[model samples]
Target: MPGPTDHGRVLVVDDEPQLLRALRINLRARGFQVATEATGAEALKAAARSAFDVIVLDLGLPDLDGLEVLAGLRGWTAVPVIVLSARTDSSDKVAALDAGADDYVTKPFGMEEFVARLRAAIRRGAASASPEPAIVKAGDVTIDLAGKRVTRAGEPVRLTPTEWGILDLLARNPGRLVGQRELLTSVWGPAYVGQSNYLRVYLASLRRKLEEDPSDPRHLLTEPGMGYRFEPS
Candidate 1:
């Protein structure tokens, strides 16, 4: 097998063989170096052993709660993780994202959509590390979206890639009400315009990184149901 390269390396974790096989095939077809594991323990071991560009994690693992796995991964890794769950409840979705899952997909999803979401998650993650111009800022926080570096009060602040993507998009269009559809489309691509959960997760993360009070955000302002506007003060 070819080694992991600039393209990407992905780990697909699911208890079911068929689902794993399907994901492996699709990810490989999309030019990702693929790795698979059927158990949460195996997934942890694989993650500990290598640096994967992304992880597609199924929420219903046989040995552990998917949230636990996500939390564990969050403890040490910054790898982008997209959750796959059969559950449709908004609470479940919120929990996983709050716990550090970068994105989520319900079961019975189209392959094209799945591929698109995976690509979005990976792209959002990769953007921080990619080369670009200088850093931008609102106040004390300096955000180098291209370099994935954030510093506030002259100290470094870490942001997840998803969070950085949100900040990057808003910074590019300062003081504009980046429509929900427009943000989802611009950040994650056209297929994700309706996936508001992705927006919620990333916005929360961005506020936590750049705001003095995330609950009462200043720079990352919510435009109610419409979308978000980044007002740099």
Candidate 2:
């Protein structure tokens, strides 16, 4: 039951009973509504039913791998997710973040740091959460925003995950200038917002795949010294 004192809703997914209990108690005491699930499958079902302010996820699950869960959630929602995992490998952390987790915390973390990270994720989720179009049409390319599929000239066009992320943001706001800074931050993360070269490379790849003329793009337009635009005419 949500109360007047509740700060926001939190969904915590971990297989450990003790850990789940601790997180629920701590989060609820901090004025956040809390839901706990032991498996990734249940977590996905709960997420589908109710919107949450943030999600704390553990990479180890009995039914579904945490990375798979992240992919499933990103297919529909932009809710902030903090991965709570026992795995300390740097590669594992990078994979989770790339798969859509907002943050990753290894096991035996301090409660203070966990809460602080969750707060940051909540802030980010608020700014990013919104509805996306089902489909967008460009000159000879078609973007199925909801399905995460794309086609060019009536043929399917395979795109890498990074390419899809860049294109998805632009297609969501057709004819609107999606600034370079926003694209860099949203797709790559805040740290890489200064890396304009990353955007150039991915955008070039997107253009090559979806544009009839890669050199003279009709749909994907670059605004000099500004950003890129998707002219969905």
| Among all candidates shown, the one with the greatest lDDT | 2
Least well predicted 10-residue stretch by lDDT in candidate 2: 124-133
Q: Relative to the unseen true structure, what is the Cα RMSD of model 1?
A: 10.9
Candidate 1 per-residue C-alpha lDDT over 23-46 given as tens digits, one digit per residue, 9 for 90 to 100: 888777778889999888899999
lDDT of 2 by residue, 119-232 (tens): 877866665554556888887778898899998788899988999999889887665556666688789887996688998888888888887789999889997656787888
How far residue 26's Cα lies from its native spot in candidate 1, in Å, is: 1.9
> Any runs in candidate 2 off by more than 4 Å, and if so which?
1-4, 130-233
Best by TM-score: 1
How many pairs in model 1 have backbone atoms within 3 A of each other, for residues 3 or more apart or on separate chains, i.e. clashes? 0
The positional error of residue 96 in candidate 1, measured at the CA in angstroms, is 0.5
TM-score of 2: 0.59
